[model samples]
Target: MVRGDPIDRRLRTLVLLGLLLGLAGCAGGAHRLPYDSWRLGLFAPNYMEVWIETADAVDVQDRVFRRAMNGVAAINTPKNLKGDPRGWPTRSGAGAGKQVLGADLPRLVYVRWQSLAEPQTYEAYIVIPEATRRAMVKPETGYCPARGIWREDYRDMLTVGLAPGGIARVWLMGGCLSAIDVVRVQGTVVKKGPYGGKSGGQHRPLSATSKAYIEKYGIPYGSW
Candidate 1:
């Protein structure tokens, strides 16, 4: 029990670390990370995160950012209708932004998107346990059976499961940035606004219009 004993010092360090973890685990009450905002707003336990970028470039226009979106969006669109949707750099702005699923998700896979300064937009579908998915997709929430061109809003969440596990995809309207971070789902959102306006139940139905849009433009990447 000596104050400066090796065992005593080790115990003290462990206690300090535990306290720091507790501070970080504000929501779930469990020791966890995501202490910084760079994580993808998934500050909880038992979650998995995957990340892919726009393949970085000297010229933002040269980046395969839209193709990255098209690569995944191809799952639903018609085979013949070619090309990933294009973007307008003047419209969406050149700043960074973050978005979140306001409600705890009920689906096995939840979508997260982040805009970056590396001339990239980050998006990922973090898969959860089936049981958790089932519990989260409440009747009122209408999270399963993902739908058409509508996206990044609460109402479209009903249509989020459009392609089984691949439903949660992100679309960027376009712009360019200078510097940024990886933004994994485990981070929290500090600065928030209408990264894209909330859908507020005003969603586009899975109509021919939407199908045509997807076929011609990919999954609602830029504007119509």
Candidate 2:
């Protein structure tokens, strides 16, 4: 497999840029950012450290993921029977509404991001776990490319699809999301794939079910 640019870098930049927009517009100005060829840059990042909190707003602590935010290692599960994989499939939080296949299987997710343009400031999110580290480590496109622009799709901060890298991917969602789904998020920024060997758009569209949820709840998700 041909190697591509690091996925982490693009993610770092996108995260920073996204936060930049939030910071710049928090006082309520809305506009667009100029440069748009999304790809990995040379900006060394600080891994936007955040306090991962649970559904009830309890902070999540760990030896790895929440702390390290790195690694592809596994932990021994509740029961370890011979041939029984003591692990769960990946999925999102119950608070994010119904479970989603391939979503990060964490109690909750927190985000911290910085960009070269806005180095001094950082933005954070205490949203549902939407992705996994492996999805970043290995993309079908090999390198992490700038997949889309962070724009508003309805009232939500949507990462609109721009293009696709010509490789098929299997996002190894951990926990209850073990069996990789047909689609996955590349980072916190955008969604990807058709599983197996098919190429897909940059992000998945809001399904009719999702629209219904939005109509009832006013937002696709609830966050703090």
Best by lDDT: 1
Clashing pairs in 2: 4-143, 88-175, 88-176, 89-175, 89-176, 89-177, 89-178, 90-176, 90-177, 90-178
lDDT of 1 by residue, 1-224 (tens): 10111223313333343334332122233212122111112110001111222111001011111211111111222334443333212222212223221222211122333321111223333322223223222222222223433222221111111121212321221111111111122322213311233533222233353355444444442231
Positional deviation of residue 102's Cα in model 1 after best superposition, in angstroms: 20
| Per-model CA lDDT versus the true structure | 0.23, 0.22
lDDT of 1: 0.23
State residue 126's C-alpha deviation in candidate 1, in Å. 12
RMSD of 1: 19.9
Off by over 4 Å in 2: 1-65, 70-104, 129-224
Tens digit of lDDT per residue, candidate 2, span 67-166? 2121111112121111211122233111111122122122222222221111121222332232432232232322212433332111111111101111
